[model samples]
Target chain A: MRIVRTVADLRAALAGARAGRIGFVPTMGALHEGHLSLLRAARAENETIVLSIFVNPTQFDEAADLTAYPRTEDRDVELAASAGVDVVFAPDASEMYPAGFATTVSVSGRIAETLEGAHRGRAHFDGVATVVVKLLLAVLPDTAYFGAKDAQQVVVVRRAVADLGIAAKIAVRPTSRDDDGLARSSRNARLSPDERRRAAAIPRALGAIRDAAAAGETDAAALRARGLDVLAGAGIDPEYLAVVDPDTLEPMQVVDRRALVAVAARAGPTRLIDNVEIDPETGR
Target chain B: MRIVRTVADLRAALAGARAGRIGFVPTMGALHEGHLSLLRAARAENETIVLSIFVNPTQFDEAADLTAYPRTEDRDVELAASAGVDVVFAPDASEMYPAGFATTVSVSGRIAETLEGAHRGRAHFDGVATVVVKLLLAVLPDTAYFGAKDAQQVVVVRRAVADLGIAAKIAVRPTSRDDDGLARSSRNARLSPDERRRAAAIPRALGAIRDAAAAGETDAAALRARGLDVLAGAGIDPEYLAVVDPDTLEPMQVVDRRALVAVAARAGPTRLIDNVEIDPETGR
Candidate 1:
């Protein structure tokens, strides 16, 4: 895979592949199996696969979260090449956002006020939406891929692209998980061995609720209660456990249609999130 | 100029042009000498010149203002063609902003907060920034031209483009004025015969401030007072008269450096704005 470190370099590379379908996966560095899965999916469907590894600082609400985000450039480059990636754009913060960058993209009401958005501090989604739109513009991809791990983010970004009249198809790939069902995440690197062991309980708790709902539960409130009990049993500190409509991310009751049972919890200092769909009548 | 109403038609026309420098000017349909000057400037600098005539509804805060906004499509097309513009895009509101469109581009806490933005109510500049950015993206022009009559808008938009990391170079063309010093504008169409005569005071007011500053009027308050007197003498309803930093649009005292003298007023029911640069030491 070719490695590009500046916007100019990426633009030059992209110019050569103008007519073909370019599948793009934008990322923050510290690639894991999950990111590789996204890349592999892109390579399968596109004539040219372009992956960007930019740890956008604007999206981080906490300064410490920005600093704590892992960096593994040398390892990432090797993994990308091994995965048959055509190009990897790893831009420094300065290149992506110069000294005086000022324009921001914001979606009001619906996407910016539910689930994860409701709990997160101000402008977090705005930062995410703005950076993603910029990346999409820079790439001009025929198809852009986002992981379902950030399902709400995918919906919000899709809305942004559609609302802006950007001519790019968006795909939300399923969340990659481990043997214990834990959702793969870059922040997983922050967990100590003991914390990692406990973190598995997050997915396990979600799985328990999914299995219960799959069996018969239809009441969203009752399902939420079951999920909360599982989290408490696992000794996890729950931030929020919600059953919401998958499309709007607004909390819903009596899951008679497509819905998501999502959860966020802190196991030690590392925060983890996981969710599963509650199928129509069975709620699974 | 060829009048193209659809996005596809506009794109196809632009595609046939040589991949050389293209200059763009976006405007509402009513063409005046001011808009003609911008087209002329673009023709001089660019390999191909393109103009868009879309009366953007999003920018109008008041429905009555929108209804009263003038549109002279036939004259505009003829004027553009005579000025040597290669293509003109005149899209309907529905085509530009289809159903479900909901994204916005924002330049926060910058100079967009005062002057025209404050007087026009919230979401006015938001709409302007969003539409301008979208148009820039669609055309991908080498340079975009805007009139300096909207001095606050010029500064705010420049800031927006810079902040968004948009590469298109923005050039602020000189404000085109009439024989009596009234700024050229599409809204001038709404001015009654008497109101049109009175509207000349807006520019005269600006000119007086410029003259005062050039004559070494160091006090900002005194400069505003004199400028307001000029508007009052012409029987124009003065909304605001102030001296501000040319670049930041921030209110300034003592025009020791390059400053702008800006005014806004109502002649009958039509609001008019005008501005000029001042050199306090010279009082020119």
Candidate 2:
């Protein structure tokens, strides 16, 4: 695998990659199974696979969280290589933001205002959208792989790619999970050992919401209440637990069709979010 | 020249155009000498030239201005073909925005605030940046030509392209003007014959500011005062008259090295904007 640290080098590598189908996976490096899953998907699907590790400062709503975020580069490169990634792009913040950087790409409206977006503020999504565009343009990937773990992020990115008329396809892989049912995330490692045990409630709460919806309880408020009760029952108070349209992220009053039940909660100084799409008929 | 009205057709045409350097000129399609200048520059510098006429509604703060905007498609195609344009993309607003379009590209901070941006609001710039990105990604041109007549517009678009890490190079052509020296613009057609004659004050004011700065006028306020004086002498009250940093568009306190002297005035219901870059050393 080749490691490129500069934009010029990244583009030079991509110039030769145009003849083949290129698949991309962008991440903040900690090299968890969630990231590996995306890389593996890209590897299986394209003749060329590129993964980028950028601890984008703009996306972090809290400075301490950014500082506390894990950085395991050597292990990450090894993990990427094992996952069959052909090129690993590790760019510093200076290269991405350079001096006089004043433009930002934003996805607004309902999708930008609920759940995690409401808690973290629009800057988080702005950071995500901007960096994603830069990465997509840098590689001009034929297909970009994203895990459904960050479901809202997938929605925002899809909106950007489609709205901007970007000439690329977004392939979302299934969310990777731990044996405890906790969604696999870099933040999962941040959980204290005991806190890790409690983290399973986050996904379970979403699962319970799906169960209620599948059982013909389609009231949006009731579905949300059921999910909240699961978290509340576990001595956990979630930031938000709501039912929303899968695409627009607009809160729905009733689950008349497929909807996304998302959850966000804090456990022992770590913030974790997980979501599931609930078909009104099947529930999961 | 072939006229392509759909994004799919445009992309299909561009796919085969990759072997050669493509130059693009995006326009509102009133097709005056101003747009012709950009087309001519693109024609000279590239093997393939793609011109688009999309009077993006999102960019217009006034619905009336959008409605009033001239669009002569048949004549536009004829002019483009005569100027050696290879492809003309004339997409309707629906073709561009469609339904569920929720993403926007914006340039914030000083550049987005002064001049036309400050006068028209950020929505004007937000619309411009969003549509410009869509067009740039649509064609993936080697170079895109823009006229310096809309000087601040040039700055905002350049900032967006650079900040987004878009691959295309931005080439700013010299502003085209009438024999009387009024800047060439589609909006210029909105002026009454008498209003057209008065429009000369716009450029004359900018010229007077440059003359003052060239002749050892180092005070920023004094430079702006002189520019404003010329407009005032013509019985015109400008929306804004100032000397600012060329790149950031921040109002300068003193003409230390170089500054942009800009003005906007309404003459008989038509708004006209003009600017000139003046270096304390060269002044023109």
Q: Write the per-residue lDDT of candidate 2 for residues B1-284, one digit (tens) a residue.
A: 78899889998988888989999999999899999989888888899999999889999988877888887888898999899998999999998998988899999888888788889988999999999999998888999999887788889999999888888999998889899889898999899888887789888888887778778888887877887787788889999887888887888898987787788889986777877888877656
> Judged by DockQ cut-offs, is candidate 1 incorrect, acceptable, medium or high?
medium
Off by over 4 Å in 1: A1-5, A281-284, B1-9, B18-20, B74-87, B213-219, B279-284
Docking class of 2: high
Residue A126 in candidate 2 has what lDDT? Answer: 92
lDDT of 1 by residue, B1-284 (tens): 57787777877888867478899998987999999899888999999898999888888988999998987888888888899999898888887787656678987664777788788865888889888887777677889999999888777788877766566899988898878788889998888989988888788777777777666787899989887887789886677786889887889986788888888899998888888888755556
lDDT of 1 by residue, A98-165 (tens): 76566789877666767667776548788888988888877889999888888878878988887676
Clashes of each: 10, 0
> Candidate 2, TM-score vs. the true structure?
0.96
**lDDT digits (tens) for residues A45-131 of candidate 2:** 899999999999999999889999999999999998888888999998889999889889899887876777899998999999999
> Candidate 2, what DockQ?
0.88
TM-score for each of the candidates? 0.90, 0.96
